[model samples]
Target: MESSMKKPAPDQHDFHFWTDEKFRIADTDLNGHINNNAVGQFYEAGRGEIISSVLGPPAKRSIGAALARVQIDYLAEAHYPGMARIGSRIARLGTSSITIAQAIFVEGRCIGMAESVIVFLDKATRKPTPMPDAVRDGFTLLG
Candidate 1:
């Protein structure tokens, strides 16, 4: 059966983590607009920040999460040599995974948005595992 899943919209109020990153000349394509890969990288950085804040230091945590899927939508072109504001938040939580919603804005205008699924896993086995209560509570507070 076909599933009906809709993309999430950019909502500033939904995000708890925010960061600003400057785009370099290398990030732009021949067209002088930021490349799709660079946009994804920005989102990844935002996710990493959120994970660190919610789950503690990577070196201290025994269990970690892995990126399972990512869906990004490009709405406008972003030029290089400018700063982009990134925002991220927890959109959904499951027994062993969480969905992160993120957006990229250039000069106060949204240029792209993304949703990513990350699965909690055992460090030794690299298999899915239930999220700890503390982690779940942390997500709740951020959400």
Candidate 2:
């Protein structure tokens, strides 16, 4: 369990991520609002985008030895074909993984929050890998 994040605040350094997304017509379930699964998908995409920007795409056949425990909180409702903007930040860093916190907003309205615990993994053994230098630098708060 080795962590790469030195600082707790990702915003202190103006480190922020914004991605434009629109709800698909198929996202709506019988309830009308976005489906339960959709929320998690949106959050994952946002978080993945942040990491991918630095590491390119994760090695599919060889992902870093890491497992993610994801938790999502829904605050408001979203409609299909609606626009959503996701913001990502780092909340905490443990010995082996980092906890990233993300929020989904539509036209400035807070709809939900998603948190994920991502571990750095070794491609060879699928075991937790020591934080790499490049990843460590990428996760560094902007400041």
TM-score of each: 0.91, 0.81
Instruction: Tell me how candidate 2 scores on lDDT.
Output: 0.71
Clashes of each: 0, 8
Candidate 2 local lDDT, 1-143, one digit each (tens): 95675323222123277777889978888989889887877887877787676567775523463447887767779988788788887677665577877778876777777778888776767778666666667666611
How good is model 2 by TM-score?
A: 0.81
Q: Tell me the alpha-carbon RMSD of every candidate.
A: 2.0, 6.2
RMSD of 1: 2.0
> Model 1 reaches what TM-score against the true structure?
0.91
